[model samples]
Target chain A: MDEEWIKTTDKKIINLIRLTRKNTLDYINKDINVSTKTTRKDLVTNVDKSNEQFLVNNIREIDPKSKILGEEGFGDNVNSMSGHVWIIDPIDGTMNFVKEKNHFAIMLALYIDGKGILGYILDVMQNKLYHGIFGKVYENDKEIFSPKNISLNNGLMGMSAPLLINDYDNMQSIAHKSSGVRIYGSAGIQFISVIKGELIGYISHLKPWDIAAGKVMCDSLGITVTTIDGNALDMVSSETVLIATKIAHKEILDLVK
Target chain B: MDEEWIKTTDKKIINLIRLTRKNTLDYINKDINVSTKTTRKDLVTNVDKSNEQFLVNNIREIDPKSKILGEEGFGDNVNSMSGHVWIIDPIDGTMNFVKEKNHFAIMLALYIDGKGILGYILDVMQNKLYHGIFGKVYENDKEIFSPKNISLNNGLMGMSAPLLINDYDNMQSIAHKSSGVRIYGSAGIQFISVIKGELIGYISHLKPWDIAAGKVMCDSLGITVTTIDGNALDMVSSETVLIATKIAHKEILDLVK
Candidate 1:
């Protein structure tokens, strides 16, 4: 809970994300040496595991007492956000990373005693780091202006493709009402768009790692991060989640409910 | 038909696009003066008109005898692609340019007696220009390799959101068949992705300006650009289009037909 601890952790996380970006790019481009945990024949599959391991190992060294939950099963099997909890999605949008090589992201969030203390989402291709320390959000070094809390009708939305196709909770109708819909195939990248006000919201069926960093960033911007049923989300369960500008939140909730 | 003519035209077009990028960004970011054909209070509306005018005027000087067809009505209303025809979409995704300031493009294509001679699609935000001359495609200075001719099941797809929602020609089912779907709100950007082999195909209802440049680039890369009905697309009308790898083209057509 100490301010000093938050500041130092923020610095370390940014550096770690940069390192992850370099190493991942190296691995993907086949520039990394095979001796450092991979076969040269197929570099993509090992990326999630190796990258998550890299993040977990560095995070462990940075905060020895914290419980880390990672997407590739490299960390603790955290079921509760008690004490110091670090939730990581080392290579979010793996398909995009493999197929497109452009829209995926790397994310980390730190919660202290169930309170989101810090979060980071690195849009690797764009080389932009969006983060929140305590309640203020920043893009790289500049503090982000709070996105206008526009309604669903006036804003662009992002959602998982399957949800829209299935019309889950009126998603097809929701897509119609929105100015447009974009599916970048990554929650972290979608969160960055929402944080920057390019997308007014993102709705997806997401796991804790998929939605955890987003919850921290959205809360910092006064954007709503909640379950589709308009309930608070615990940082453990997979749920249908909607992260949006405040008014869009209420509008989307009304339509789906 | 001359190689020298195509080479010179390519150089001139690239220079023109660089200038267009500078002016467009200035207009959007409010760095340009109000005297430059816009009122300071609302610049978004004027962008399409002014940008098209800029391109049209330059094209006239570059190739005096050529006929121009422009999206913003700055040029001819010709119904035929004959003798040195240039089609332009100065701001291909005005909604995106105004809404997200990303995923939009400036497209220009030259058709000589019904044959695509040269084409360009500049993804302004990412600063990528996908272009073709005769039968070769290049990204900036480097020639682009042909994308792997993957099947529909092996590749990602892009579609217009409305079509996907309406299930036009079983689009929702098609969504399930492909690896996944993305809706990026601009035909030109989507075309760039396909040219780069990021998306195997893009299906959309597009205007002449929207599909002309794409036709040229896709043809150069040996990618198939056709009507959803598996017919050739003449560069003079709006139509439901599919720009895909060869195998994926047949697969997608079989689904809809």
Candidate 2:
């Protein structure tokens, strides 16, 4: 997606994501079909399937030339990021959606030749839509200023709960060194916090759909999103990723290493 | 206060809290004066003082006969929860209010002769008001049903950061036994999660205003709010409190002990 094309599709992509949220909310009002995938912690709901299908079908119609990768396997068998590729997490934080019925999100992102172009995340419960077009990010209709580049000691952090609890890679020390730690139980919600500058950073192992939208948005601001050992993120892997402000990012990378 | 009088004050108290939130939002738009109270974490902002003053004055006029204990020193210095007493935490999570401008709450509760009567907690940014009258809890006028009594292994738990990080009182084992762990950085927000059955329990040290509203609400919902040792909560002291569903409550008490 070129700059002009990215700008042009913002309204359409946003509208489609908004409609997706409406449909997801409607499904929650009725009984849901939930199943355990790889593990009990790894769950997929009927809502996730239908939402992914809806997004994939619409994206294929809107951009006939693009390839798509979706969490629920509703899209193409994507291998590489060539030409135009869209990533979809029909419902990020499905656990929260199933357990809490709140704090869940709808996420979508567009990439061109492995570079992020446009990304959208809607915190459906809060009714807040956050999106990035190239280098400018907006909360709803208001463009957000980049958060200050603060160090770990000066800011809060969000960490994977199990990792933080079990002291994985010195995560316990990381949590204590920061001003505070938060675990909202949603990758999308935690990404929103980092993008909005509420949390200086978050560390989690994320699949492609989970990392794509945030990576695109963070690239616009001066934030860092990389593998735990500070490598470029693979476009199609479930890798341990660290998303943080520039300064805190460096501090954490060195500490964990 | 009689049950009838308590019923009459519902609309008035709710309206006052709503107005206080309006004022609090307005203040956030302008510059704020922040001062360290006891510790950096235990901060008190200009908004805290003013909101407490506003609530204290209004309660005096509305009830006139009740004694008030407020977080910001705007009300009486009472040692006991005797007779009609009202407690106020004008801004619960002041750090969050000052730093994130979200996830904070405005809290007020009424106690008659050392028994909980009415309690109100407003999640300001979410614009969600949850209250309890006598033994019935309401989340914005809609009555809430009792959450299932679940054990530690069957549900998520919220642990205080320092305790969990340092493994205080075997917090690490407790966190591991539960399905998951969360740390949201706000007492009021965590309390809401437990009352709504989102979490099976949460443990933290809380002051009077911090515990009052949640305690009253939990009393109505069969949730447990007590000292870590399972003793009755002391409303005046900053006690280490554990609030949970009944079964999870006992399970945590045993694990921590």
True contacts kept of 2: 0.57
lDDT of 1 by residue, A1-257 (tens): 68997788788889999999998888787642222223221123577778899999998999999999987789999988888999999888877787788898998999888888888898888888988887888888999978898988778899999899999999988888888898888889999989888999999998888887878878878999989989999888889998889898999888997
iRMS of candidate 2, Å: 1.4
Worst 10 residues of 2 chain A by lDDT: A1-10
Model 1 bad stretches (over 4 Å): A31-44, B31-44
DockQ of each: 0.48, 0.64
- lDDT tens per residue, model 2, B66-102: 8999999989988998788999999998878876888
* Cα deviation of B194, candidate 2, in Å: 2.0
Pairs clashing within candidate 2: none
User: Whose lDDT is greatest here?
Assistant: 2
Error (Å) of candidate 2 at residue B123 is 1.0
lDDT of 1 by residue, B136-173 (tens): 88888799989999998767898988899899998988
True contacts kept of each: 0.67, 0.57
Off by over 4 Å in 2: A1-8
